[model samples]
Target: MAPTAHSAVIAALRAVGVAPDAYGPTLNTAQSPRDVDVVGEGLAGEIRAVAAPAALVVWDTSDEAVLAHVVARNLDIGVLRAFEVEGLLRVSPDVPAGAPVALLATQWGERRLAGLRTLVANRGGQTVAVAAALTSPALAAVTDVPTAALASSDEVTGVPS
Candidate 1:
């Protein structure tokens, strides 16, 4: 089974105790280089915990290093682009189990969970990703990322990749 979106990598980062103030631009979108700095810091710690491969889904190309940091820390990473609910849904079903993923987006707060769940389930076991809201409010607001953006496995597997 694959990791779910609830326990996604970013959520796990929070679960492990990384300060929000040290992780991003705001809490919505990851636009500031400062936000990436925070994410990289927290991600460094996360990478040390897991022994398996992981992936990251980012909304911007600017986030490659953030993803690379995770990979360098020892986790695997994949990149996704978008903060919209539907965009995440389109990319979720492909996360591999034991391979947590990270989601980097702008501040959306608690307005998006349905999409997170759908994406998280793609991993099968539990969600695994480090999510960074590249904007403000500095907290997930909710326990998990949004799931509203996810689509069925059949719909996502064939995506461009």
Candidate 2:
């Protein structure tokens, strides 16, 4: 089964060897309710910011939950320089992809042209391939890399150009 947000958050905390109870009060944001607004969004932001190649530890099993907890909590204790599995895998030039190639597409048919370049750069400066729900002239400007038409943003998952 897919992990719930609570499970994911708990796992993130434990990854860093933190006691689950140590997390301060969960905040409620002006946005959605289920969006369990952690008081220090900065904590999550820091973890994600340093995670190059966009180390995305998507918890498919219980194992990842453990890993997530460690990452989440340990990162908050101090500015740790240790590498997580995702962090290592993301930056390792030896990986088959050399650099990860991301597919940027929008489900809502918004203009992807402006955002694609920045998203790719932000995500470990990886090569970007643009996919769009509908074709647009702006996408044509992205010539140095590959571009394609995707049925929806969801299709971009794990799809390399």
Candidate 3:
């Protein structure tokens, strides 16, 4: 199996003697609503930010409502249960309503650009990836890394490049 972009990033960080501890939860702006810090009627309220990824349907056996949202601001990904609005300011890194945000299942598809629509520019010196999904939006923008190569390739890259 090929090394994941996350693994590769970690390896590079280690090569430079950068401790993973540097980021830790500090780098984690996108947090789960169940984390206590976030408490509200819904994921948006829990996140305390608007447009923080919504209604992410997942495949689970129990069939209980499980949704995963991303903090488009800091590349933070999280899952939560569905609920009503908590009434807060729209401050998260999520794309605005009707901004053509695609709720994908983390699988690369023809609409890669739509996925990139969710990413917000880094704020407060946050470390964020070019694509919110990391390499899916990058698949089209794939380039050589040492001798690494993409299994399959396309140019329908998403996000603001």
Candidate 4:
């Protein structure tokens, strides 16, 4: 049987020496209804600032809800569309140089990462991949740089929502 998402996330975190439970119960409370909206807004703002004329590729339906919320805000930055990985790969849209491309996912998996890499290679743009959990593996896979390097690099910054 396949491991559940929760288990997979926990295992991924543990593989990188992150004790999932090290934070204890204080970090395990229920999320508020507005949490997704808040996160989405921040992410949307970041994407808009850097890559206004960008495409948003979402990996899961849950993420699409965030996309919808982002769209409803009518930020007027540019055309923001959500595509499945396969569809985006097939479409292979043209991305202008220096424009930002964003991938939104609640979890990271091999297939999704591979697709994002391919899309970036084919489209040619600054890449930003955001995962709801932001595990170490996810960060490394998205950046193709050592996590330590990312920690020191001014180019990459993470704000926890």
Candidate 5:
């Protein structure tokens, strides 16, 4: 069966860790992107456990690497660059039997779960459950002990300022 859009996105992310050759691009560290995605904040330090010093951490929140990958994939590569996407859904391969770890996403996040689930399964994790929000009574009832949830908020303290 064909992979879903979410799965495809996940595949793209897991595919990003580079086998960098010599003569790589440099980071200023002072610059900022006008927008960003896939904020894997702890990935660099986490990667140190598995990689040598020169290994390229592709998920680093740097525009140059991010843009390069985006262009290479011919994917939409801009900030606040919104669009509606339809995704295929399928049972993840090699999901651990009733594993507690799983994906929960909506909008963009939901789209990436397809690839992400495979990565999770590879890491001995299981994306056993997923949902966009707690608004559904069925979801709320079933997810009494959900391990993680994701959302944005206008509820931030200074947001209305």
Candidate 6:
């Protein structure tokens, strides 16, 4: 059977020498706003492990509540909401040039990859790290960007491998 996203994330954490159990409880207990969806298990841990300290985490607005909880927990972490461009969510142009950027996503698609590439190019070619619940071949094809696949399927869309 294909690995579930939750399992994938745990494996990735182990591969990095971080025990998933170390942060699982902390994330599970995070207090998120009532209106926004909470980030799934393993995702926040992956972000904490993969993203550099002080890196600006760019994410979909729908994830604001949980991501905010993450940022609150880690005072050094920063966040930015992806902005709409041509009806697709793209990295915001306001990200400071040369700032380390981490894309925290629940899924990957052509539009998301395009936005990442554009952000990289616009930011003086600094590679952007990605910590996502679901990934695709297109995401893997980008050899330069570092990524952590934190889940097997798109939880929001129920798209399984």
Q: lDDT: which candidate is best?
A: 6
lDDT of each: 0.39, 0.31, 0.25, 0.40, 0.29, 0.48
The residue pairs found clashing in candidate 3 are 113-158
Global CA lDDT computed for model 3: 0.25
Residue pairs in clash, model 6 = 5-151, 5-152
lDDT of 1: 0.39
Residue pairs that clash (backbone atoms under 3 angstroms), model 4: none
TM per model? 0.39, 0.28, 0.20, 0.44, 0.25, 0.56
For candidate 1, write residues 32-149 as lDDT tens digits: 4344344454444443443233555543333343444443443434544334454334443355565555554433343343354455565453554434322223233434533211
Residue-wise C-alpha lDDT for candidate 3, range 1-161, written one tens digit per residue = 22463243333222222112211101122233333122112222222332333323211111112223332222244332212135221223433343322132222333332222222211111111112221244434433211111122121121234
Q: What clash count does candidate 1 reach? A: 57
Best by TM-score: 6
Instruction: Please tell me which model should have the higher TM-score, number 1 or number 5.
Output: 1
| Candidate 2 accuracy as lDDT | 0.31
Cand. 1 TM to true fold? 0.39
Ranking by lDDT: 6, 4, 1, 2, 5, 3
**Model 2 residue 140 lDDT score:** 59
Give the clash count for each candidate.
57, 14, 1, 0, 8, 2
RMSD of each: 14.1, 15.6, 15.7, 12.0, 16.1, 9.4
For residue 127, what is the lDDT in candidate 4? 58
lDDT of 2 by residue, 1-161 (tens): 12353344433222222111111111122233222223123224433333322222221223223333333343442110112264221222222233444332211123333443343354444543443222345655667756543222122222343
> Taking the tens digit of each residue's C-alpha lDDT, what string does model 6 give over 66-139?
54445435545556555656765455445666766666544456565567557655654354576555556655
> Model 5, 18-95: lDDT tens per residue?
222212222222232211133122222222222222111122234334432322232221111111136422332333
Model 6 poorest 10 in a row by lDDT: 18-27
Q: Superposing every Cα of model 6 onto the true structure, what RMSD results?
A: 9.4
Give the C-alpha lDDT of model 5. 0.29
Off by over 4 Å in 5: 1-38, 42-89, 106-143, 147-151, 155-161
